[model samples]
Target: MIDEKEHGDVMEIDKELMTKIYDLRRRLHSIPEASMHEMQTKAVLMSFLRENTDLEIVDRGAWFYAVLKSSDDRIGDEERTPIAFRADMDAVCGQDGKPGHYCGHDGHSSILCGAAAWLSRASQNQIINRGVYFIFQPGEEIGAGARLCRDLIIEKNIGEIYGLHNIPGYPRNHVLTIDGTFACASTGLEIHMIGTASHAAYPEAGKNPGPALARLLLEIEELTEEYNRSRGFVRMTLIGMDIGNANYGVAASEGTLRMTVRAEREKVFAGYVDEIKQIAQNTADDGGFTLDIQEIERFPATENHAVNVDKLRKCAADQNIVVTELAEPMRWSEDFGYYLQETKGAFFGVGDGEDHAQLHTAGFEFPDEIIETAVKMFVGLALM
Candidate 1:
C-alpha cells in the first residue's frame, strides 16, 4: 500500500503542470492523424518529452517509448521487475469523414506524458525502486499498433502493463476496472461473390449472386443465434452490402457482403469466423460463383489479469479516486490485448462524465479534468 506522504506527493498537480498538460492535449487534438500515419503526432510528443523531461526516448518508426530508470541501491530483487503504461496516439474519423480526435486519444497521450513528467520529478527526491516504460503507440484506431508494440514487453521482460480509455456516460474522473475480459474480441468479415453478368431480360442466361448473398445473410443470422445460445455473448452486424450497380440492362453478377463479428472469448470468435467462411463457400458453390473472404481490423479480447486488477484498485484507492467495477465486458475492442497476451496487465477506463458527448462523434472532445486523476493513478501504480 502507498503511504499517505507518497500519495500526497504523487497527487500534487500544480498550476503550471496542469496548464502544460492541457496545452499538450489541445495541440494533439488540433493535429489529429489517422492510424499508421501519426508522424506529426509522434514528433510533437517526442519534442515535449525532450523539452520537459530528461528521460531517454527511443523512436521505433511507427511507435515510441520513453524510459525512466531507477538506481536505488536499497531496492529489493522482487521489486525490480519493470512495468509499462501505454497510450494510443491514433485518431478516428469524425462525422465529417476526416480524421479527428473523436475518441479522446489526445487526452490519453497527454495523461501519459503528464505521468512521465511527474515521474521525472519524483525520481529526483525519491528513490524509485523499479523502472517504468511509457509507450506512445500508433495505429490503435485500426487495431495494428499494440501488435507491433507488444514486442517491447517481451524484450524488456516487463512484469505488468496498464492502459486506459476515456469513456463517456459515466461520472467524470471515475476509474473503471474489471477482473476478466475488459473488452470484446472483434473483426470485420467481408465476403465477395463473383459471377458472369448477362442481359437482364434473360436472367437465367447469367449467374446472379443476389440469391446466394441473401441466403448467406440468413445463414449468418442462424449462426449468430446458435453461438449466442451455446457459447458466451456473440454478435454479428451487417455493416454494408453491394450487389452490383443500377445498370438496368445488365444482370447483377457480383456482390460483396461486409459485417463485423464480435465475441467475449477468442475461441468462440475464431469458431464463428470459420463457420462464416464455410457458409460463404457453400453458398458460392451452390450459386455457381467464386467466393472470397477477408478479415480486417482484427482485435483480440482485452483480458485483464486478476492480480493486476487488484493492484489497479489499490492504486486508485491510494490516490483517493473512485473506482467502479464493470458489470460486463465492453462491446468494443482494444488492441492492448496484444500486450496482456505476453505479460500480466489490465486495461481500464476513465469516466468522462454522463453528459459528455459520446466517442467517435463530431462534437466529442476530451475533458481536461481527468488528466490529474489518470496521472495520479498511473504514478501510484508505478510506485506500487
Candidate 2:
C-alpha cells in the first residue's frame, strides 16, 4: 500500500495554474486523437505556448519540442548540454472502441505544459546552469513518434532526457523506477499457408493444411517454453488464427496465424522472430504448401541508464517524495525506448492510486490530482 502521509508535500499545486492545466487537459480529453493523427491536439498546445510562454518552438510534422535557454552568459563561452523532458500527446481507443484519454496522455501532456509555463515565468538569472527542452510527441501508441523525433534530439545535442507514466495500483504521488531494462521488446508476426482446395469427398485429391498448421502451432509453443527456460523471459501470444472458410464440404486451401512475440532483450526477440519464420517455412515445405510471414508492428526495449535512475531517486528523496525501485522491468513496450537508445536517460512511473482503474480500461481516467505531482517531478529533474 502507498504511504498517504508522504504525498502531502509533493501534491501542492498553485490554485490559479491548476485551473488552466485542468482546462487544457479536459479540452484535450474531449477531442481525443489517435496516434499519427494529433492535429487538433498539436494546435491547442501550440496556441497555449504562444499565448503563455516565451520559448522557441520547432515543429516536426505532428510533434514539436520547445527550447528554453538558460540566462547564464556562459552559453556562448562554453557549450552546456541541454536536458529534455518528453510527454506523449496522443490518445488511444478504450475497451469500448471509442477514442478517449483512457491512457492518461492528456494528463501527461498537461503536466509537461505546466512545467514549461513555470520555466517561462522564471527570471532569466534563475536558469543559470543548464538549458531545458519540453518535447510534445505524437503517435506513441503505434510506436513511431519517438523515432521521428530522433533527428531533433541529435541536432540539439541534448545530453540527457527524462520521461514518466502514471501507473495505477500504486500509492498516489509516489514515484517508481527501475535500473537496467525498463520494458521489453515486442512485435506482431503473421503467417499464411496456402495449399490446394479440393472437395471433402475426395480428400485424397486435395491438400488440407489443418494437420500442418496444428504441428506448427505446437512447435511455436515448444519454442516459447524453450526460450523461457533459456532466456528467463518470453511472452508469445497467438492472437489470431484462421484455417479456412465456413464451407462445410470443401477442403481447406488457405490458413493464417497471427501472434505477438516479446522478450526482455532485443536480440532474443529477434531470434524468436527468425525461429518462428524458419518453423513456418519448414512446416510449409514438408506439407507441400506455400508460406508467407509478415511483421505487423515492432517496438524495442526501453533501457534505463544506472546514473540517470540514481539521479531520479536523489531528486525524489530531496523533495520528500516517496520512491520505490521496481523489482522487474515492465513487460509492456513503449516508444520512448527509442529516445533512451540515443541519450542518457530514464523513464519512471508515478502512482495513480491503488483504487484507480487500470490503464487502457474503459473506465480508466487520469486523475487531475496527480498533475501537480508530475509537474513537481519534471521541475525537479530540470533543476537537478
Candidate 3:
C-alpha cells in the first residue's frame, strides 16, 4: 500500500500536464491508422514521449516500448524484474470505409502516455522503486499486435503486465475486473467448398456444392449447441456466406462460409475449433467436394492472475476509484491474452460513461474524462 503522501502524489495531475495529455489524445484521435500499419501513429507517440520525458525509447518496427529505470541502486532480482503497462495504438475501419478511432484505442494510448509522464516525474523524485515499461502496440483490432509484441516480456524479464479497455455502458471512472478469463478466446473460421460446375439445364452433369454447404451449416449449428450444453459459454456467429456467381447457365460449384467462434476456456476453445474442422471435413467427404479451412484473427482467452487482480483492486481503492467486479467475462477477444500466457498480469476496464455509445459503432468516440482516472490506477499499480 502507498503511504498518504505517496497516494496524494500518485493521484495528483498537474493542470498543464493534463492539458498536454488531452491534446495528445486528440492528436492521436485525429490520425487513426489500421492495425500492423501504424507508422504515423507510432511517430506521434514517440514524439510525445521524447518531448515530455527523458526515457529510453526502443522502436520495435510495428510497436515500441519506453523504459524508465529506477533510481535505486539495489541489484536484487526483484528490482531487476520490471512491470509493464500497455496500450493499443491501432484504430478500426469506420462505416465510411476509412480507419477511425471507433474502439477507443486512441484514448487507451493516451492514458498510457499519461502514466508515462507521471512515472517519469515520480522516478525523478525517487518515489518509484522498480523499473517501468510503457508499451504502445499496434494491430489490436485484428488480433495481430500482441502476438508480434509479447516477446518483449520474455526478453526484458518483465514481472507483471497490465492493460485496460474503456467500457461504454458503465459509470465513468469505475474500475472493472474479473478473477479469470476477463475476455473470451475467439477465432475466425473460413471454410471453402469446391465442386465441379454443371450446366444449369442438366444439373446432374456435375457436382454442386449447395447440398454440402447446407449440410455443413446444420452440422455447425448442432456442434455449437452441443458445446454450449456441456462445455462453458460457446458462441458461433455466421458472419457471411457466398455461393458461386450470377451466371444463369452455370451451376454453382463453389461456396464459402465465414464465422467467428468463441469460448471461455482455452482448451475448450481449441476443442471446439477441432470439432468444427472435423465436421467440415466430413461434410466435404460425404459430398465429394474439396475442403479448405483457415483460421484467422485467433486470440486466446485473457485470463487474469489472481494476485494481479488483487493488486488492481487495491490500487483502485487507494485512488478512491469505484471497483466493480464483473459478473461474467466479456465475449469480445483481446490479443493481450498472449502476454498473460507468457507472464503473470491482469487486463481490466475503465468505464467511459453510463450512456456512452458502444465501441466500434459509427457514433462511438472515446471519452477524454477517464484519462486521469486510468493514469492514477496505473501509477498506483506501479507503486505497489
Candidate 2's TM-score: 0.92
Which portions of model 2 miss their true places by more than 4 Å? 1-13, 73-79, 95-97
In terms of lDDT, the poorest run of 10 residues in model 2 is 1-10
What is the RMSD of candidate 2? 4.0
Please write out the lDDT profile of model 3 over residues 155-195, one tens digit for every residue: 88899999999999999999999999999999999999999
Candidate 3: where are CA atoms >4 Å away? 1-10
Residues 1-384 of candidate 1: C-alpha lDDT, one tens digit per residue = 122374434456667877999999999999999999999999999999998888999999999999998766533455568889999999997657689999999999999999998887777766467888999999998899998999999898888999999999988999999889999999999999999999999989999998899989999999999999999899999999999898999999999999999998878888988999999998999888999899999999898999999999989887778999989999999999999999999999999999999998888999999988998888888877
TM-score of 1: 0.95
Query: Which ranges in model 1 have alpha carbons more than 4 Å from their true place?
Result: 1-10, 73-79
Q: RMSDs, each prediction? A: 2.2, 4.0, 2.0
Report the lDDT tens digits of candidate 2 across residue range 319-382. Answer: 7888988888888888888998888899999999989999888788898888877887887777
> TM-scores, in order shown?
0.95, 0.92, 0.96
